[model samples]
Target: MEVVVNRQDRRKRRLVRLFLRLLLISLVFAAACAVGLLSYTKMQGPPPLNVTQTTVYYGADQSIIGEHHQGENRHWLPISSIDTEVIEATLAVEDRKFYSHFGFDPTRIGAAVLANLKTGSKSQGASTITQQYARNLYLSHDKTWKRKWNELLYSLRLEMNYDKDQILEGYLNTVYYGHGAYGIEAAAQHYFGKTAEQLNLAEASMLAGIPKGPSYYSPLFDLERAKKRQGVVLQSMVATGYLNQIEADEAHLEELTFVQNELDQPSTIGPYFQDTVEKELIQTIGIDQALFEAGGLKIYTTLDPQMQKEAEKWVASEMPDSELQTALVAIDPRTGDVKALVGGKDYTESPYNRATEAKRQPGSSFKPFLYYAALENGYTAATTLLSEETTFTIDEGRGSWSPSNFNDNYADDFITLLQATAFSDNIYAVKTHLLLGTDKLVEVAERVGVESKLKNHPSLALGTSGVSPFEMARAYSAFANGGKRVEPRLIRKIVDSEGEVLFEAEPEMTQVLDPKLAFIMTDLMTGMFDPYLNAHTSVTGGSVSHLVSRPIAGKSGSTSSDSWMVGFTPQLVTSVWVGYDKGNLQKPAEGQIAKRIWAQFTEGALKGQLKKEFPVPAGVVGVKMNPENGLLATEDCPTHRVSYFVEGTEPTKPCPPPAADGQPETEVIDEATKEKENLINRLFRWLGN
Candidate 1:
């Protein structure tokens, strides 16, 4: 009996010890698995806070010109940059146990579950700050079990990899406020019209209450509701020991000034220019589209706000009341930085950026490119082409083409390159184009940064090819910038949210033309404004010549459907196009509107600027010559001006003195005999008197 009792006791003790060992092994395995999972999660670096922020565009003067964002207007700031009051208010309202908890608050979660279960609804929320941030970044704000499970996993990953302050900073930057604002910084700017650092305690409490229910609690939406929510935020702050009850009461009583509603915010300045900058940033600068989506970029552009205003003002004031639409672009000649741009009459009504996008026939405004080719091929300002009505026989397949001047007017005799350019003579231009093979003009256009595909034809010299005002401005910049080809630039530099430099323009320059040829070409362009070059017709720019307060080199051009005035000073280059949206013939009076707009815009934009003239290069020489015959000036010559040429290109022959009579041989100033004398003749006659 004793043996049986002892055996039973021993067997029972063995069974008990085996059960204890099994339970201990299970507990140890579970602990080891948990440790391994935590280590693996920590190895994965901090999850990306994919926060969308606002991108601000600054003008040349460092003034805010525009802003861009996706759905949210957000600006990220470091935790240290954020005010303490904002942090305290947010933490008090969001998660008081943020620093103590690993990722979520179990106590609060239990209480919320109990409340929801009892109410038979899922309205209660127990998401900690980390959990909310994780949801904002990688998950959606749905109350489904799957979304909550994913949010919990993301929160653990973030908390394990990043510090408490880092998670808090990310949360503060990504949390959405009302009125298209996300993050405290953007909310501060939108509501208070001040920076995050400038927010007072009252403003901080008021802003903190917005994220609870942005539509209901936004001060801009409802003052009474906002005040009530702010009181709740203040009470929470006092309970969390961040503020005393007395301080909370004082803040609740403080008067807060909210900014005008976001709907009432004025449209950004230089919308067309801003659009161009964005395009250049993406296309020309090769910025990643994703970077723009993630926003928080500072793009420093070359826009001149004052000049932009001047351009808009003049385009609005001078544009004809007809259906004539216009586009204007101004660029710094030396740097190729676009200073001002006006795409249309009203950007709100029409956002078509004609200055940078619309391509139209530039008429004689494109003559400079043709003349540039001529200059390179040893043609000087003194070179002559007969400006008479004539037909040119082409190859047998294409047949013959005839060119006519404006209003069927002609010089009849030989006209110097200076005179032909001033008169915009179509007959002389075609002759010059044929003289230089069509390929040479195309080559010159490409070398000078004209990106448009030009059709190689005789009429191309007469400006039949279609190109944008931007392309025209870029092409002319080479002439204005001492023959250096400059890529037109809108953005000067770009910085990312982390202060990383994404792009900085270095002002690309290539010497595409002989400095001497460029100078001579520029001088020839000036002839359009000079009355001395007038002969059969008025200089094309004569109508606006009186508006010239300084030496301006320019050209006026017109096709049946398009009108253009592209001109430049030493400091600036501007291209203005006036026309209908569709191809419609312009009225005769409409043809002159481009010149008026150009003149007014240039005069107004350059109001306080120095009056600069194109500088002559070292290899070029200025020689006084007969404007009609392209010969050296003689004592009896009635009209003469300084024509610039390469050292060897100046004419050797002198004008014959008076054809052996007191009456001059050539009709230099024939105002008395010519019945069709225009403004140029009147000015020259006035000067002769």
Candidate 2:
């Protein structure tokens, strides 16, 4: 019996020795791992604390214009900026041993581990403020072992690198409160309509209790529950020696005025413009969407607040309150910076940004592109095409397309290019389009910053291609800027939260057009406002000409469903479009509204600005010519006007001496001659096809 008992004791002692040896090995392995992790973390330096802060957008003058966040309205505040009561309450509830412990409280952790084991779940948490902040910054709040292990390493690294105050401040700044509020500063503002520094003891305690379960403890979510949480916080503060019993009781009894209605959010000056900036940052500028939303970027945009207000104001007042939607965009001709933009009459009802998204046929507004091509292809402002009813041959003469002038009106005679453009003579424009191959116009459109896809259709000259107002403005900016490529830019610079410049815009320009040809086209566009250029039809811009107090060059275009007015000066380019959504037919009465809005906005936006003229480039000469014929003006001509021309393109001959009769001689076309001319035009059309 004694020998059997000795054997049992010996077996028990051996089992105990084996357990001790294994435990010692495990301790050594864990210590080595901890030391290696610490060394690695130390070499890595401090972890970034700028997690998920609110991105602020500023206008040209550096005034706040907009803000964005990743569903959490986080705003960072220093520990000094935070209220004393808030810190005390947070420390009392979150980590009483915060200053004394390294990064975690082992006593509380041991107790929590036992409790979690008993519950068979991670229902009990003992994270100190430092550990919580580390998790908030780097790891997700999953109760899994992997996340917890990562949290432990991160927390240790933080404690080694930063002081206690830094961890506390970072925690206060990044901890999430409810209702889209992420930090204590945002929380104080959200709940009390005051800043974190202005928080009273009552408000501080209320805010400090929110991090436990933001949705459940938010006063906005439930006042009674929040008050109970606040009471617990006050009692904890008292127990932690941060508050006396009397003070705690007084704070608990104090009546707090929660913000009734959300503090009137400062209205963003231009919502559509803001959206475009965000888009350019992500899509065109190649910024990651996650970083753009959560990186706390300081976006400095080119928007002029006053100009934006005027744009919205004029659009609202001038636009008739109907289902007809409108889009307006204004840009600086020189810098290519978008100054103001309105996507639609109401953004809430529809977030579709028509300024940048809607692709409507620009109608006659597209003629400028064709005209520019003509100038490039040996056609001058003095060039003439017979404006008569004509049918054009297409596809090797397999089909015919007949184009008519507005109101079926026609000069039925030779008219100068200036007159053709001023009158918007469709017959003349079509003849010119076919004369210059369709590819020329498409090439010109692309070079001048029209990004929309253009097809080589004969009707493209009459503005059959769909383009957005934003593209139209950019295209016209080249003309206004003397032939330099103008890429629309909304954000001038972007900075990260740490004051590092993420991106900065440099004024880049490529000479895309002959400076002389661009200047001449700009000069020709002004003919739309000149009554002297009127022949069969009124000048396209004549209705709004009287509204111009300065030398403003502009054009108006209309399709069955869309209306557009694009205009510019040396300083600014503005484009306005009015139309029904989804291409519904627009009423004739609404046609003039686009012009009115353009004129009013242009005049308003440039009201106090200097009147600048388009600088005529070298190698161009001005000559007085007969408005009726593209000939040097003589004493017999009824009207004379100065026309700018490339030095050699001016007509060498004066108008033919007046006939024996006092009136000028008119070309008399006999029937045979007319038929022969018609056959010749058809032959050219066939050849072009």
**Model 1 reaches what TM-score against the true structure?**
0.85
Instruction: Give lDDT: candidate 1, residue 211.
Output: 90
List where candidate 2 sits over 4 angstroms from the true fold: 1-50, 77-98, 101-161, 176-179, 184-267, 632-638, 651-662, 667-689
lDDT of 1: 0.85
Give every collision pair in model 1.
none
Per-residue lDDT tens digits for candidate 2, residues 404-484, read: 888889887778888887888888778777877788889999999898898789989889989999999998988888899
CA-RMSD of model 1: 7.0
In order, what lDDT does every prediction score?
A: 0.85, 0.85
User: Mind giving the per-residue lDDT tens digits that candidate 1 earns over 1-689?
Assistant: 99999999999999999998998998898888768767766887678766778899999999988889887888899999998999999999989999999898889989999999999988999999999999889987888879987887788899898899999999999898878888998899888889888888999999998998988888887899999999999999999999999999999999988776764264457999988888878887789999887889999999999999989988888886766799999998788889999999889989999998898999989888888887766566766666788988887457998778888998787777888888888887887777668898889989988888898887888788889999888889888889999888888899999999988887778998888778888888998988756667889888898886988897888888999999989888999999999977556888887888888888888888899878877866788888887788877674678888676657777887776657556656553233223223323432342
- For candidate 2, the per-residue lDDT at 219 reads 79
TM-score of every candidate relative to the true structure? 0.85, 0.75
